[model samples]
Target: MIRHATTADFEFIFELYMHPAINPWLLYEPMDAVHFQPIFQELLERKVLYVFEVAEIPVGMCKLVPEEHRSAHVLYVGGIGIHPSFAGNGYGVQLMEAIKLFADAEGYRRLELSVAAINEKAMHVYEKAGFLKEGILRKYTYQKAEDRYLDEVMMSCLL
Candidate 1:
């Protein structure tokens, strides 16, 4: 189940965010808990973060940001990640479905996201969830630690 995250969920959320298998694809640079706390708290206060639970245990998280421009019909999926231990069990698909449902319920006309070009696994999951490749964002994301730029694929699914 997907629901709004609370401050109490911080420890689990931190683990998910900094997991070795998941953090590389995330937009934020890896940092210690002390440094990440402020950002996480901000996200919660902004009310854009949602946590996915399996049998009452948090297993994943996602961000849904509503577009504020003229195209208010679009909702951007900022990021989504399942715990590595729960990966490959269709949880990603479930999360995508939940995002789509949330978008539709919120009257969004499209759901958009950008995935790192090298993240084939996530690309496949997005494709299976009905998102189509819209374009390539050349050298769109920079990895501060690695000192490299990574290409990203822009994708969207009409709601």
Candidate 2:
């Protein structure tokens, strides 16, 4: 099942976000309950966060932000993660489909997301989801803890 995420799902979401398989790709350090409480609350109020479950077990999450307040008519998809145990099980594709359905129903004309250059698995998933590589932003993100830079690949799909 794919559905809007509620506050109760935060703990599970945090666990998935912190899973070892996800660390290298995620932008932020693993979050704790306290760290996610406020953000989850805000997402719930804004109707932007989504959770995916299979057999009643939470498996992944995706967050989308509209660009009305920004420079484009695009919707930004951020922070998509599947638990390590659920990776490669097609949950990522299902999450992408759900996002597409929501975008189409909301009259959105484009969807955009950024992926780290080294995250090949996620890049492949995005491509399979119909998103095309737009360009790469050199040293787009800095991992302060690691004292290194990461290139970001920009991708978008026209609906």
Candidate 3:
């Protein structure tokens, strides 16, 4: 099941956010309870975060942020991640489809997102969901462990 996230799911979401396997691709540092509490509270209030549940267990999440600086007709997918245990089970595609449908219903003209250049799996998933490679942002994000920069590939889909 896919549904808007609630404050009650914060613990599970935080666990996933701090998962070691996900650290490398994350743009922000791992969250402690102090950091995540307020964010999860805001997410519940804003209703912009969605989670995928398998038999009532959270498996993945997608967060969307409206493009306020530009036109309201565009929505940006801020983040999408699935638990490593669920990676090969097609949950990512299901989550993408849900996002696309939600965007269409909300009258968004386009959906935009960025993926780390080295994340081939996520790029493939986005491409399969009808997002096209738009461009690249050089040194877009900082890689903490490597102490270097990483490129981000911009992608978009016309809803």
Candidate 4:
């Protein structure tokens, strides 16, 4: 089930974001609770954070930012990750489906997201979800820790 995340899911959220296998793919670096709390709180306040649960156990999450600007009628997906234990269990697909339904219901005519070009696994999932490659964003995301830039693939699906 995909539902709005709540403060009660903090431990699961923190653990997932801090997981070595997942953190690098996330939008932000894993910080100690002192720094992470405020960012988490802000996301909650924005109401864009969602939790994916299996058998009522939190296993993953995704953040969708709605954009209704004149040039874009889309929902931007970010901070998507599935716990390592839950990977390849179809939970990711379930999460994508839920996001699609939510976007459609909310009148978003397009869904947009970006993935690092190196992340082939995620690119396959996005394609399966009906998003087409828009273009490559050269040096779009900077990894401060790595002190290097990564190419990003911009993708979108028309609802």
TM-score of each: 0.96, 0.88, 0.89, 0.94
**Which residues of candidate 4, in runs, are more than 4 Å off?**
none
Please rank every candidate by lDDT, starting with the best.
1, 4, 3, 2
Candidate 1 lDDT score at position 90: 94
Better of 1 and 4 by lDDT: 1
Candidate 2 local lDDT, 1-159, one digit each (tens): 568888788787777666767755765665677886776688789988878777877888888888875545689998799887777788887778778988888788899999999888898999888999999999988877578899999999889
Q: Runs in model 2 with CA error above 4 Å? A: 69-72
lDDT of each: 0.90, 0.82, 0.84, 0.87
Clash statistics: count for each candidate: 0, 0, 0, 0
In model 3, residue pairs whose N, Cα or C atoms come closer than 3 Å (at least 3 residues apart or on different chains), thus clashing, are none
Error of 4 at 50 (Å): 0.6
Candidate number achieving the greatest lDDT relative to the actual structure: 1
Q: CA shift at 32, candidate 4, in angstroms? A: 1.1
TM-score ranking, best first: 1, 4, 3, 2
Query: Which whole-number lDDT from 0 to 100 does residue 91 have in model 2?
Result: 83
Judge candidate 2 at residue 152 and give its lDDT: 95
Off by more than 4 A, model 3: 54-56
Best candidate according to TM-score: 1
Per-residue lDDT over 65-142 for candidate 1, one digit per residue giving the tens place of the 0 to 100 score: 888879899988975999988988999988898889888888999999999999999999999999999999999999
Give the 10-residue window scoring lowest on summed lDDT in candidate 2: 23-32
